[model samples]
Target: MSQMQQITAQGRQIEQDSFAIIDHEIERDHGGHSFSPEQWAVVRRAIHTSGDFEFAKLFHFSDGAVERGIEAIRNGAKIISDVNMIVTGLAPRRMQPFGVEAHCLISDPEVIAEATEQGSTRAKVAMQYAARLGWLDGGIIAIGNAPTALYEAMSLCQQGKINPALIIGLPVGFVKADESKRDLMATQLPYIACDGRKGGSPLVVAALHALMVEAAK
Candidate 1:
């Protein structure tokens, strides 16, 4: 039941060591911004997952984002990710207890064809398709590779086409990445984001895992 024994059994000494390093780094580099306990936990895990102290500063969340995300997960909300990487990174066991599955439609032939026909990115098309299928309604959206996907999701919410329970918008790119997240913040939706275009699939999965762990508790 101890941390060290569990680490040895799981062969996750690297992860344990990384968390130790993250704790040391945070103590060494923490600034004036004091986060709430929940926010701190998410930020701490993100740092532990990526070994990036900068993430502690870059991560952003709307008011009650974590609470709402945990609620949705506890209610067995499906997770719709923008890319396959996010889906692949998600541990099935982590979500199985919630009776939900992680899904990605970017590679689906219909999604690809629609993206090409509409002159849009596959990520954007995938979001639109999910919306059309009523999948985003009350679902958790995890977007980590394409800004267009986040933008499309926000637009759908604006148009009253869908209402996702929570959105993890961390797409990493210069073109419209920061702007897309900024726009997402303007909406009424709860969201977790990494500001200024500094996020990726790993961070997205890390955020979800943190939320799921928090929900389980």
Candidate 2:
């Protein structure tokens, strides 16, 4: 059999082994946070996907996050991200069940022009333009690369320029990553974030994919 076939065939066994390790070896911290049943499913899946034990401790979900994300999926909310890598990682097979599409407009010429004219980064400019789109009124926004992108999304939401169903802000960097997440946490909006600079496109995609999996269920 082919290598791909072999891997596919062992999928169940792999999952079993992973779960065994998590259940038998890993332990939650003393007086640490815990998640709801649905939220726990996402966290478990993320740990399996990334092979990162820290995931369980890193993920922070605002109250009612799972329910809100599921409702948005059922309502056919679109997903937008700051970078193309995020859109690429979110496979169509997983997103099709919800009848939604993933979008990344960071490289659009208009966005570039707006950024140059406004003296802002393309990532921020993209968000500024996207905030005017009617579809994002209740869509999901994911930011995994640039901190400015996350800040723009939050600003748009706070100003009533756009209202997203949920925002997954986990951009990775030393500059403003931690501060952006802190700002997100301070907001009244529903959000899921990795609380420090230890985040990136892959982590953001994982969180989103986990939510989509739960929504499908």
Cα error of candidate 1 at position 44, Å: 1.4
Please report the TM-score between candidate 1 and the true structure. 0.90
Mind giving the per-residue lDDT tens digits that candidate 1 earns over 86-136? 999988878989987889999999999989998889999999989888889
* Backbone clashes in model 1: 0
Q: Which is the leading candidate under lDDT?
A: 1
